[model samples]
Target: MGALDIFCYTLWILGSVTAFPFGDTLNRQAVLKTNIQTTAQFPNNTWLENIAVRANGQLLVTTIVPDAAVYQVDPTQSHEPLLVAKFPSALACFGIVELGLDEFIVTTNNWTLSTAASPPGSNSAWKIDMTTFSESSGQGAVITKVADISTATYLNGMTVLDKTAGTVLMGDATLGVIFYLDTYSGEYEVVLDDVLMKITVPGPVKLGINGVRLLGDELYFTNNNQGLFVKVPIEKDGTAKGPYEIVARFDTILDDFAFDTTGNSYVTTDPDNTVDFVTQKGSVTTVLGNKNSTLVAGATSAAFGRTFEDEGILYIPTNGGLAGPVNGTFIEGGKVMAFDTSVVA
Candidate 1:
């Protein structure tokens, strides 16, 4: 038989038996999709910019508003109230990563410290302990400043290397450099200096190497304004040991991404409100998202579910609402969405 025949025959036979992980008994149609729904909206956000699923299955998200705060979502309760970890007026957080035990490392740009005469406020990173956090109190959480990038051009995303040693790394969007911080000393250093990370402003779009992910022996990051996907092999200490290589290029402008066990990337296309899949073999395809759908407006970043039940699922967060290709299809303010990946071909 041919490839198409094999696919059709299989769909006609066992599609019903394998529907649990993919769907409920809503309808009687064959399991044509990997899941019954392409994406499910999780109602949490005011201007969410990034998302990371903790080992404990809590959904942690970051916001972009001046009154910015971090939030936690409980997957078990469908209508659970958002748990907010409020930040002071001077600090607004962007990127966040889990550091175990309800603790997280977050990146910040203190816009309040910016002066009308000099460069923008010096950037910094922090460790937020949500252990005894109370959304009502909104101010007593234990917070520590990790990296003080007083001279940093612009700081965006971050990743943790050694939670025990308090080692964290951040990407500079404006100066094109990578800096690692010693959480213990609260000091940071320029560890990687490469032209490949140089910032770009094409017409009106301003972005650079925004988000970085450390794979087994390599690092992958998104260069937005340049529309290039870059990857570099690194040493055990996180220093680049090889020149940056272009894995893929697109005109859509990529944002943050998460990799599956198969090494496939679930990447976000900023204003497009779309998530594109970069397969393990280097092919690119769109998974769930439409220019006109509020389903995933201004899609910013994605992370896979860590629970045994949700292992391969993808959770995407948006930068609120924006205009799509359609005449009136605009995205509403921020949201967190879960997309069924088994649906992907």
Candidate 2:
């Protein structure tokens, strides 16, 4: 068989042998009494990967499968989503982060889902300027290619390390390293590499150090293979200042996460169809969805609403288990889900 066929065969073998555990083994319940609601829904097979909230309270969602594009969704109104931009050459758009007031940075990849493979020199980054963008006016934002990071494989999640310096850190899942990129000059380098960031599982499905974020001087990341959410002290330039510390552990894999004002994190468990709440002190609980709940099924990434009216609500974008469906059978169209955090237990 050919290379693509061989790769597909390998994935099929892994899928048959691997046992991805679901459910709350710790008996964790809803930490917050969340009023979950579907804010926006995409077509079936749309793999919504990551999310970022615009200053005006709209959410920018990145789609990896079916189409490699960025969509703008206004949570206040359940209307149709507005197309922000599309990457025709790439097969998927993976991560997004707000760099400036209304400007954002995004990562795109040329990987195929069926074959589970990506061609070399197919990874790149872009900038989307939405300062003067308006949904009704039909005015499109300025799209710019910032850097071509072909050296790093599978750039999944991103977080701004130093906004003033225009520096951002992107997690390279396959390479088990973080690429430090300067958005202005398009210069990039491998900033952080450690065993903690390496993948423990053998297959291509489970990734290592998939989600990354920076708060103050601490760097936080999640490894899907190891099922670990960890944090470490880091410099402004993306260098680790201290050793990595384990924040929490999970049986299922983690995709991406968003931090609230109070330092709590709402993380997405892809196959488990759940959004986990991780407190600053490392308290882990299932605050929304579960192995059976469709509210946030196939949840991939999350972000909190920017406006004061919805600041307490955590906005989650789900793939509806596009890659790994709930119970290995249930799947739905990718959609944006909102969990009101103000309604506490």
Candidate 3:
């Protein structure tokens, strides 16, 4: 071959190797062994909604019970949450995360029993002291408000970015935007908007952004109705680059997600109903399913916690199945279930 031809061939090979997609090749699997023995049920008064872990390993959970209470469940015994605070009745707690050693924040929706398409409450977020369980209302804890956006509605999912001065990033499902809220100052700004594409399914497919997780420089989110998981690139300038790509697709409603230190992302699906764990490479395996009729109802959200003394376990909450007799309840008596990830294959 001529010298110029050989050089061109080398450049082609190099470019091909550099541009090869590496994320799709990884195999993700979540082998869920049903552990009926380890199940921890929450009290009837408290309907567990979402859960978060503190730096010290204590679990902070939000509930739908009266008094806007945030419960702290011992890592060892998650069934019984130690009641931390009983704030005002107006606070309709949705998701929660710890801000510091003795403080935390919780998100609220409108105080309504119906799941109608309505805007989330404009009530400012509240900051609570973990030590005294004292809450400061009115913009102290609100990172962002619906008023901040001319037409914003619901704030569904939230997670704390510890590296960013403890700022919390929240998903507003109603308007398809992600807001970055300053926990310390209550100032908020839109970091991501129109990032998720609406699922064009006929007859009300649950197609809005639900759960979000940050893995390295990439942000992953769930499209609940379409059962799709997507990954977006995070630029150095604190913005995300998209043409957002779908990583995995399942047959259920994807709700919430949590990642272990090993980069395995666990997802909870409702309606069609199942729980799955996906690896960083976009492969999925079912951890919990209705195959054996084991999970009495559809799984809503899940969080990982320490079991016994130091082993890791998963805590899942169920929204009773549609065909079952106990339908239409947010979380009934048989709502909470636990699995020991250390023992599951």
Q: Evaluate model 3: give its TM-score.
A: 0.74
Q: Which number leads on lDDT?
A: 2
Q: Candidate 3 overall Cα lDDT vs. reference?
A: 0.57
For model 2, name the residue pairs that clash.
Answer: 298-321
Candidate 2 structure quality by residue, lDDT tens digits, 124-228: 999999987878964669999999997987898899877788999999987888999999999999989988789766765556889998766777898888888
What is the TM-score (0 to 1) of candidate 1?
0.80
Given candidate 1, what's the lDDT at residue 226?
A: 75
| Clashing pairs in model 1, backbone N/Cα/C closer than 3 A | 320-334, 321-331
How far does residue 233 in candidate 1 sit from its true spot (Å)?
1.1
TM-score of each: 0.80, 0.89, 0.74
Native-structure RMSD, model 1: 10.4
Top candidate by TM-score:
2
How far out, in Å, is residue 43 in model 1? 9.2
Ranking by lDDT: 2, 1, 3
Per-residue lDDT, model 2, residue 178, is 93
Backbone Cα, N, C clashes tallied per candidate: 2, 1, 2
Instruction: For candidate 3, write residues 94-182 as lDDT tens digits.
Output: 66765665566777655333443335444345666655432222112222232232234666677665534767777765566677777
lDDT of 2 at 307: 62
